[model samples]
Target: MNYPFCIRCGWVLALTFASCYPGLAQTPTPARDTSFTVYSALAKARKTDPSITLARPAVPTIIRSRMNVPYCTASGRALQLDVFYPKARRQGGYPAVLLIHGGGWRSGDRSQHVPMAQQLAARGFVAVTAEYRLSTEAPYPAAVQDLKAAVRWMRANARTYRINPKQIATWGFSAGGQLAALVGTTNEETRFDSLACNIGYSSQVQAIVDVDGILAFIHPESGEGDDRKSTSAATYWFGSPKTERPDLWRQASALTYVGPHTPPTLFLNSSVDRMHAGRDDMMRQLSQFNIYHEVHTFPDAPHPFPLFNPWFSPTLDYTVAFLNKVFSRK
Candidate 1:
């Protein structure tokens, strides 16, 4: 189910880190990597205790969701972003989150994450759900580039939007999670940088939140993606399978770029999501890099569980805690 579940189309959604530290002049390259898979983590935990309690559901929070705000122009197309802003700020401008939705880089829309964004806003962050060019329009780096352009556009207009550009984060779900991870991991690498618009401003983000995104296409976890003849979404995004164009998959893999400077990251994943390719490796790399990171796994949940109820509230709680911890850092 690429589309998010609408438990309450009518239902709704803070923290303040403003005026604490100065922001960056240019997008700073952060060192970053990955570690154990959630499944492995679960196996290890259950080894200690056969029965582990499921996490409690978090209460819902609502905020004002503003839709269809134009953020950038890419390849002659206007990219739009939906913002979820906290109704009131703690003091200065609110920290921003560049929210991305997922659909295997083939199908999905910014609207899928509207509920999560609204909750984040109510929690005191200015969250924006960005639209990107899917594989249908463009492949591989195009979506990544579009997202980078969106970040720059958001930063450029931070003042008008009452957001703190310095405090911006990249948060994505599923395929969007992969893009968000790429956006965070790639940093200012010119290879992933976009010339579309807002080129002068930096797209560096302080934190990354990935919700069950596939981080590595070349990893065995994706299943049957190495064959060029197959029609997997990985091929759609890479334009070819790993067997034909290994470089493309390697270059696009978020796991490939993890370094010492990768920003603080948090992942919310399902216990059975093999779609989360390279998670074990990425987490290992992050641990090796000694970066602050965390992952919470939901037992027997679906890939799209974060967008549904029962799981929805707990997912929001996990998200709010992670973002607050990262954004509040001194």
Candidate 2:
């Protein structure tokens, strides 16, 4: 139940002050110091297992990629995404998967998942890595809305990308995993939809891949919002401690929306227990509805296992298998 705290106490105090003063709230909130990048995560992982190394990005000749493609304009910012697809197209189109990075909703970028996207593309799938407004730029629902927008963009430009609009899935790591779950579960829910881009297109994903992400922010197994020790990433994103804004805490949880409409989910987790918060409850609901779900946990693996060698291969295999099963792709 011991997760590393990311945001400092001073940052939380400043946010608190901004919330109190109406005039000060209009002023731009200064960005917090977020150093959680792929290299940083690899460094931490190496300390535990020297054999672990960073996954470098590469574009194979068989895989075609388009970088910095604008997907949507939100909060006066142009949210962009990177696309990786196979050079050889299928008759209709290929199943697509949107890759989302994890950095406690504050750090990390679309490039973090470039390697995975390329690999998926080479394996007969259309893959995309997208950028969203972080908590430092915008909080909570903004990231969720941006992700849904990315889904709609994929469908809007389906012919151009040779993507099967009906076979789109979402795969996310850590915080991104949580966002993916939320977007997948809340399909057709107007509240999370943005009119920014691809207005008439749907944002629904057919499947979800959650890797080391918590399903509920305020669940019994959750370590978020424990501000008495330090400001957690969840606290910063919600702009309030769990005690002060329990409503928002519960509202943002993917567990809140899991029902008959929820899509099949695949969970790839580490040995970390707290990271699996609300997962059991979610699987129970899925079983009640007879919605297919799968889970795989790496023994003693770090939370960022997807970014390293030993775990990365298996993670990719599991993901491809799950998506193939869901989308009926070979």
Task: Identify the leading candidate in terms of TM-score.
Answer: 2
For all predicted structures, in order, the TM-scores are: 0.79, 0.92
Assess the local accuracy of residue 238 in candidate 2 as a C-alpha lDDT between 0 and 100: 71
- Backbone clash tally for model 2? 0
The superposed Cα distance between candidate 2 and the true structure at residue 221, in angstroms, equals 0.7
Inter-residue clash pairs, candidate 2: none
Cα lDDT computed for each candidate against the true fold = 0.71, 0.84
lDDT of 2 at 174: 92
Best by lDDT: 2
| lDDT accuracy of residue 123 in candidate 1 | 79
TM-score (C-alpha) between model 2 and the true structure:
0.92
Stretches of model 2 off by over 4 angstroms after superposition: 1-17, 20-33
lDDT per residue, candidate 2, 1-330, as tens digits?
223444333443446537832222333435543568888888888898999977764667898989999999976768899999999979889999999999988788888888899999988999999999877676677899899989999999999999999999999999989888888989858898865688899999999999988899888899887767756778767776778778988888999999998999999999988887999999999999999999999999999999888888899999999999988832
